[model samples]
Target: MDLRFRDPQTRIGNLADEPILVVCPRCSRRATVTPERLTCAGCALVRVRSAPNYSVWNGPVDPFFREPLWLRADCCGGHTLWAFHERHLDLLERFIAAKLRERGLGDDPGLTLVARLPAWITAAKHRDEVLRTIAKLRATLS
Candidate 1:
């Protein structure tokens, strides 16, 4: 099947609404993080967000609590890749897998996450390696 995509106009902020999978600081196991709370299954630790205000996060860390994300892998010449959650990772997988990707047809295309993706993430030469890294990250969930 042809991998074609018409940009969805999704922003990274919109993705944070989904659960953020973070490495539990207490148990070194997977933890679930939301805008309001963080809960770890292995450690039975629960913490509420003390400071709700957030600066934009675009790295391998949770936005609200600033904890390292659980689903992370090394790729693309030692660059660490990560995702907030399954949905976030799925979005990245689909975006990277697409053979023909179009920019958003919105007021400002630059506002979309796809437009803001790093050059290494979007470059054709790195496609296979990046997809492999994404697969490695996805494997962490299961």
Candidate 2:
């Protein structure tokens, strides 16, 4: 597919509708996390936040619970690849997959998720490796 991304200026919170993948603190297994709670089916563990005060996060952790994300893999020589959820992954995949990526900075550039992505992720030399890492992350979804 010849995809093109014009930087929709999508913020990290825009993808909050989907559950973030997180590692269960108890079982070290995969779990689903949201602003309110973290649920682990493998060990039947659940933790709810009293006050859901979270900011937009761009790393390998749930914004609310602050647990390590379940969907992360090593890539680009010492850099870690991560996504908040399926929707976030979809966005990253499209941006990286595109041969033509246009930077459309909105009023507040920091709020734009793609703009905040690490430099190595957008580097042409690392494109193939990044795609491979993305595929590996997707495989862990199930």
TM-score of each: 0.93, 0.89
Off by over 4 Å in 2: 53-56, 105-110
The whole-model lDDT of each prediction reads: 0.86, 0.85
Return the top candidate by lDDT.
1
Q: What are the per-residue Cα lDDT tens digits for candidate 1 across 98-120? A: 99998888999998988888888
TM-score of 2: 0.89
